[model samples]
Target chain A: MLAFKLAFKNIFGAGYRTILNIAVLSFAFVTIIFYNGVIDGWNQQARRDTIEWEIGQGQLWHPSYDPLDYFSYQDAHGPIPEGMREEVSAGRLTPILIAQASAFPQGRMQGVLLKGIPPGQAILKIPTHELEAQDGQVPALIGKRMAQSIKMKEDDRLLLRWRDKNGAFDALEVTIAGVFDCNVPTIDGGQVWLPLAQLQEMLGMPGEATLLVAGEGFTPTGNTGWAFKDHDYLLADLNKIIQSKKGGSGVIYGLLLIIALLAIFDTQVLAIFRRQKEIGTYIALGMTRWQVVGIFTVEGAAYSILAILLGALYGGPLLWYLGKVGWAMPSGSQDMGISIAEKIYPVYGAGLIITTVLLVVVSATIVSFLPARKIARLNPTDALKGKIQ
Target chain B: MESIIQIKGLTKQFPVGAGKFTALRDISLEFHRGEFTGFVGPSGSGKTTLLNIIGSLDTPTEGEVTVLGRSIAHLTHKQSAQLRNQHLGFIFQTYNLFPVYTVYENVEFALLLQRLPTAERRKAVLDALEWVGLTDKMDSKPAQLSGGEGQRVAIARAMVKRPAILLADEPTANLDSKNSHHILQTMKQLNEELQTTFLFATHDEKVMGYLRRIISLEDGRVVKDEEIIMDKITEG
Candidate 1:
């Protein structure tokens, strides 16, 4: 306790030196926390946007379904799962039928993924409610990215071609009902949504779907003809992308840590060198060499405590302000082929805050201890004389 | 009377180039209760080295020294520190008070090291400061103090523990004549009142004049030891 008090006194007594050290460390604290908070916010926003725009609470895929393999999608369609029929009728489950097709927009041919969804279903946010089952022409909904790619627009007329279950080629003219804008690229780019029943009838395959999306708060009771995909498994690829992003950000974190520790280490070394006479005075006043060393080490470590306090003093308001206004991403960031919002709010999580604080405190203590041990080996007589050796 | 410090044939040496140079040689001395003594010498006469050995700052290279009942040569580093902390107080010529601390804090430091109770530590520190006529300068930092005042604070620090012996090395070397005489008078009065044994290593005659006994050293050997009449001694 005496060592701590004395060290505290010594640190504040150091005037500008102590303040400079504290400022450097506090800057590190704010930067580290802010960088981590942004990454966490991006991850959170990605997960949420993916959920609302693509996968709802969870997904159920056909046994043969393999999104990466187009041929497998041909075999992916099957009759509706028997157990999910009631939920499907109650609007709790939404089934989507996928097929590969091509569209001729302004006489230019472009490949597309033909997705069929219930016009009145509320399970996802695709704006398929604008779809009509039997207009004078098939009414379709396309995303802005798809519309831009095909040179099509709202209410444009186009020709879509596909094959039936029996391998017969067919074509039809469709009227674009609406163009839905979404953050999820998987749903937005090169995709067209039509009424489920109409597409089922057009393909000559009634009552078949490639996937079923459960609404929010729905739980799977048991196995149907399809395999149940929980949220984690469904978002596994996104998690991988986030983990890779965290690794990339880890380099920045490492660089910041190196810079911070170097400053602290330098300060500790300089202070110990300059205070040799004081160290000797401590020993002469009846302090054990270890106790003198403790005072020095504790004085160095106390800088971190002040840094944390200083960081909170300025960083708290800065973070809160940033959180409220959010960080506006660079324009056209959505084309990166990942789901991301235009603005991301940084989150201050307990886990992140605690981990960062612990890392800083422990590192500061270690850096302090290294130089202070040098004092213990000094001869008191030489130290009292202020001899460098 | 039992001796508080006992030194027998004590010698200290330092490595110089290839051979060793001896600082003190074949010196035997005993310091007892309430003695105000000074080791008088010129430069390189080993007065400070002898004081260092007795203060447990250095060990004798050839012989044994026992102070306050503990053998200096056999004690570990921690035990040596314990001896200094518990039974000995030191005042240096440079007045090496912690520059950042106030006069009172400087005086309170030794008591804090001993982990004395707060009330007792406060009283002892205040009393010691009063003895040195520095109670009014309790809040003055070392940088704010004059040379004599700094030395006085050092004296108060050393005496706050009321140790059995006080070791001062060139205590008046940095002070002016007036400050020197004033500090010496304070020390004389402290010796009379507290009966604290005072030992000094000095080349300053002004310091010598205040001592009750003077031991003269030359070339690592004691040449003369004489008791002085306190009434007749005068500062040159």
Candidate 2:
């Protein structure tokens, strides 16, 4: 208790020096929490967007289908199993037929993926209802990114060519029924959506699908001639990307902590060096050498405590405001080939704050103790004389 | 006339380069309660060394020294600290007050080590400050005080706990003659009123004039041990 009292007195008595150290430490404290909070928020936003716009609760893929390998689209799909046909009709599962195709817009050839889904499907957030044929023309939906690249808009006509299962090529004039805006780049760029019946007829493959998306809360059972992919498997890539970003941010955290701790370490060393007489005075006043060490160690740890108070003074309101208004990501972020939204609101968990507090306080204490241990070896007589030991 | 500090054949040595330099040779002494005693000598005469052993700040190389009935040589670090905290007090020439603490806090520090109760501690601190006539400067930091005031605060700090023995090493070395005499008179009065054994190591003549007993040393050995007749000398 005496050590704590004296430590606080000494720290406050130090005046501006104490404030400077606290400022640096508080910077580290607030920066760490804010950076991690932003990353966590981005991860959460990306995960939700991917789930809502692309993968629902999970997915079921055809046995031979490989989403990453474009050549698999040629022969990856098969007839939908009889057991899952009821699920498809009940809207619990939505089947999608994908084919590698080419589109000619303004006489410019561009390769695209033609995905066919039920016009009235409600499993995903895509504007598939606009895919209903109108006025003897095939109506299709494209993402804003795809529409921008093709220079096509609603009601614009484009020539789409694809090969059927019999190696026969077919061409058709499709009208752009709608252009939807989506944050998930993988679901947006280079993709066009059309009615399942039209694509199936064009490909001469009826009742066939490349994949099945399970709706919210839907659980797969029995044989469906397809592999059930759970959320963990479906979101593995996204999780890996998030983890990688966190790893990169870890370096910044380390550098910040090291800088703050280095300042504290230097101050501790200097205090011990200059306060020899005061140390001797404590010994002379009946304090044990260990007690003297405790005073110095607590003095250093007290910096972190002060910093926590200082950080909360300014950082609290700033963090709260940021959480409210969110951070707007710069334009063209969608082209990074990963899921990111326009604005991300940071999520600061109780665990993050507690863990950060412990990390800083514990680190400050250890650095303080390192230099204070030298006091145990100090000769009281020499210290009284203000002689270096 | 109770012997509270007893020393017999004490020797202290320090390492200088490869060889050991003996600071204090075989020496024996006894200090009774309430006596105003001073160890007088020139530089390198081992005055401070002998005082340090009595204060339990340093141990003897070869002797049995006892302070307040505990063997100084055998006392562990904690026991030595307890001995100092409970029964002994120390004052240094440099007035080693904690620069950050105020005069009241400095005086209260010794009593704090004893963990005195709050009301009692406050009373004791105020009384100690009153003794040094520093009640008006209780809130002033050491840096704000003059050298004499600083030394007086150090004296108050040493006396706050009312220890059985007070060891002062050149307490008035940094003071002018007037301030030195004033500090000595205050200490002499405290010694008389409280019967607290006052032991000082100094070469200052002003301090020697106030001692009831003087032990002079030359080269590491006691050269003269005498009792002063206070009535023969006029008050300064």
Candidate 3:
């Protein structure tokens, strides 16, 4: 402890050098913090969009559901297991039947996959539904592109006709309660969400659903796949499926780590050069050679700690701002206009910050080792003579 | 007086390129407790090398240096450091004060080497400072003081720990005549009052005149070992 205190005092003793070294480290700190924040924010945004679109916190599939299966929903049957319902008792689960169908809205028709959702339960899961300006009545939300194709609006009438299992035309009257907008333009243009009861009646399956999509924070002990638990997992899976074609955050983070290592190395090497005489003096005064090495290593560690503190002070607020106003990606289709969130969400995780600080300090200290060793091997007479090599 | 430092035919060699140069040839010397002794030699006469051997800064190539009954020739580097801390004090001609430390802090460094308690160290340091008549300038840094004041601080540092032996390498080389005389008197007073052994390497005549025993060397070999017999009139 006494040696550590002495080292600390010596570092601060050279006031101008300490300040200059910190300034150089600060530049690296800002670069690393901003890069980490942006990548993390984008990842979180993708997860949010994924969970909002398809999978909820806990998704239940059959015990036979394949881990590598892309067509599980098409082969599955019935709604969620009875026990799974009790697990998420506080949050509602929406049973959905997804099937491809040919729709003729006004004689110019196209094939669209109609996802029959449990209407009342889905209201709590969709972001728009939760934030709707309701006036004492529940509204059926239809995508903007679906409304535009049928030339419909709120209170407008539309006829959705599809062929059933028996090859007979099954038609229904769906009132356009409201027009909805999600950032994914392709899904918005082709997808239509209807009440499960209405779909069952039209297709003549009185009380059955093919798939179940729950909201965030659902847990099922028996069986589940592609499931989400809390915000982080949901974001991870969401980023995986939604932004699969774009550049990933892992590459960006790797590059950022390299830059951080180089910056810390440069700064620590400079600091070692400036304190050459002092280190030699300490060694000549009966300090162990390793003790001399330890003092500078500790100084490097202190630099990392200070940089992390400063980075957190700035990065926290920056992430919060990004979460409030996320960025957008351009959509290739006119009808299905693609735009991600305007600003990405920030995650204030303690583990990530600590790991980053440790990484920076360890690399910087290792870089400073060559100089520390050189000082330890210095002849006492040469040191007292003030000769530099 | 019992011998505090015993040397047996010590030698040191320095490598210059492919050939080896002898810095100190086979020679032996002893330092007794409570003695004021001086080693006088010309430049490159191996005075500094001999001093370093006694101070445990350099190892002998052929023989052993036993200080306080411990063989330093075979001790590890760490053990040598421990030995120096426990039994040795050094005053350099450059005054080697840590530029960032005040005179008080510089003096306290020696006591800290002994690992004494803070209160005891403070008392010892202040007392040493008073002994050198630099108590009024204890708070001043070496850069803020004259060359003489800096040398006095170095003296206080060497004496503060009250080690078994103090090694001084040309302690008055940088000081003027007046400061040199004052420093010599202060050292003599310390030797008489504290009964501490002082060993110095010097080329100055003033330093030789103040010593009770002088050993002169040329070509890395001792040429004369003179003991000044004190008379009653000369003592005054």
Q: Which portions of model 2 show Cα errors greater than 4 Å?
A: B233-236
Identify the CAPRI category of the predicted complex in candidate 1: medium
Candidates sorted by TM-score, best first: 2, 1, 3
Q: Write the per-residue lDDT of candidate 2 for residues A1-389, one digit (tens) a residue.
A: 99999999999998888888899999999989988898999999988889888888888899989999999999988898888898898998899999989999999998989999999889889988898778888999998888888899999998999999988988998999999998888777888788999999999989999999999657799987799998899899999998999999988987998899998999999999899999988998899999999999999899999998999999999999999999888888878888887888999999999999999999999999999999999888888888865
Rank by DockQ (best first): 2, 1, 3
Instruction: Give a tens-digit lDDT track for model 1, residues A1-389.
Output: 99899999898888998898888888888888888888899899899889888899898899999988988877789999898888899888899999988888999888888899999889898888789654577899998878888888888998999988888999999999999888788998888899999889888879999999999757788778688888899899988988888888878877877777788788888887788878877887788899988887787679888989999999999998998999988878887887777888988899998888887878888898898899878888878778855
Q: B109 in model 3: Cα distance from truth in Å? A: 1.9
On DockQ, the candidate that comes out on top is 2
- TM-scores, all candidates, are 0.94, 0.97, 0.77
Best by TM-score: 2
TM-score: model 2 vs. ground truth: 0.97
Decide which is better by lDDT, 1 or 2: 2
lDDT of 1 at B50: 88
